[model samples]
Target: LIKEYLPGVSILFPYRLLKTEDPLPHSWDVTSDTIAAWVAKQTSALFIKATDVDGIFGEEKVIKNILASDFSEHFDSCIDPALPEFLQKNKMECIIINGKFPERVIQAVYGRPVHCTTVKGNI
Candidate 1:
């Protein structure tokens, strides 16, 4: 168990129940932006999202860097519906790093260039 290995860790679980028809109970309609705001204000944590690709791309073209506001404009085409809406509601800086790479996680956390979708704002 995590407590047995890491005693200093504290966990917070904010559970929400969706519609009865929905099968997933743990996840709500919350957006990534909302989560980011909470992270910034509530915890001293770094928010990073790892995915299957290098980053946010438009029609096969990769967008190296984009501000939060810009992301909102292009969000409909780029983001998935299942993702929390907080990502679009708040300007949370998140990186969609590559999950396949062995060191992608470390690179993103350390500010290194990793293949992924890096969205700093709404998009």
Candidate 2:
């Protein structure tokens, strides 16, 4: 279906197993955020997580940008539990933005500045 509709674009379904080999975990820890990051790592594309919140929050403040090395040093919110570690390990960055506002999604896709949290890769 993807080849006929989206063409070159690729989409990963966390709930659906493509095959018996190397399947993702069927646990809550693996949400769409982590799934997207995993897909990005596989496709060599950027990963962006659109959530209801503006971004990740810790200590009552929104962390705008952070490196993967320091990603574990903060409170977890707005993303799946396994996302940060997976992204860091794969050297893949992830941008978390507000899905409530559709424009932010476009901004994130284009690498434009948006009110979001950028979890840096291991580079």
Off by over 4 Å in 1: 1-12, 16-37, 72-74, 77-91
RMSDs, each prediction? Answer: 6.3, 3.2
Best by lDDT: 2
Candidate 1 lDDT over 53-122, as tens digits, reads 6677777877777665554434653344433344445545666666677598898888887666665655
Question: Candidate 1: lDDT over CA atoms?
Answer: 0.55
Candidate 1 vs. true structure, TM-score: 0.57
lDDT per residue (tens digit) for residues 4-95 in model 2: 34767754454443343354666788877776677667668777887888887868777899876675535567777777678777877888
| Candidate 2 minimal-lDDT segment of 10 residues | 14-23
For residue 103, model 1's alpha carbon misses the true position, in angstroms, by 1.0
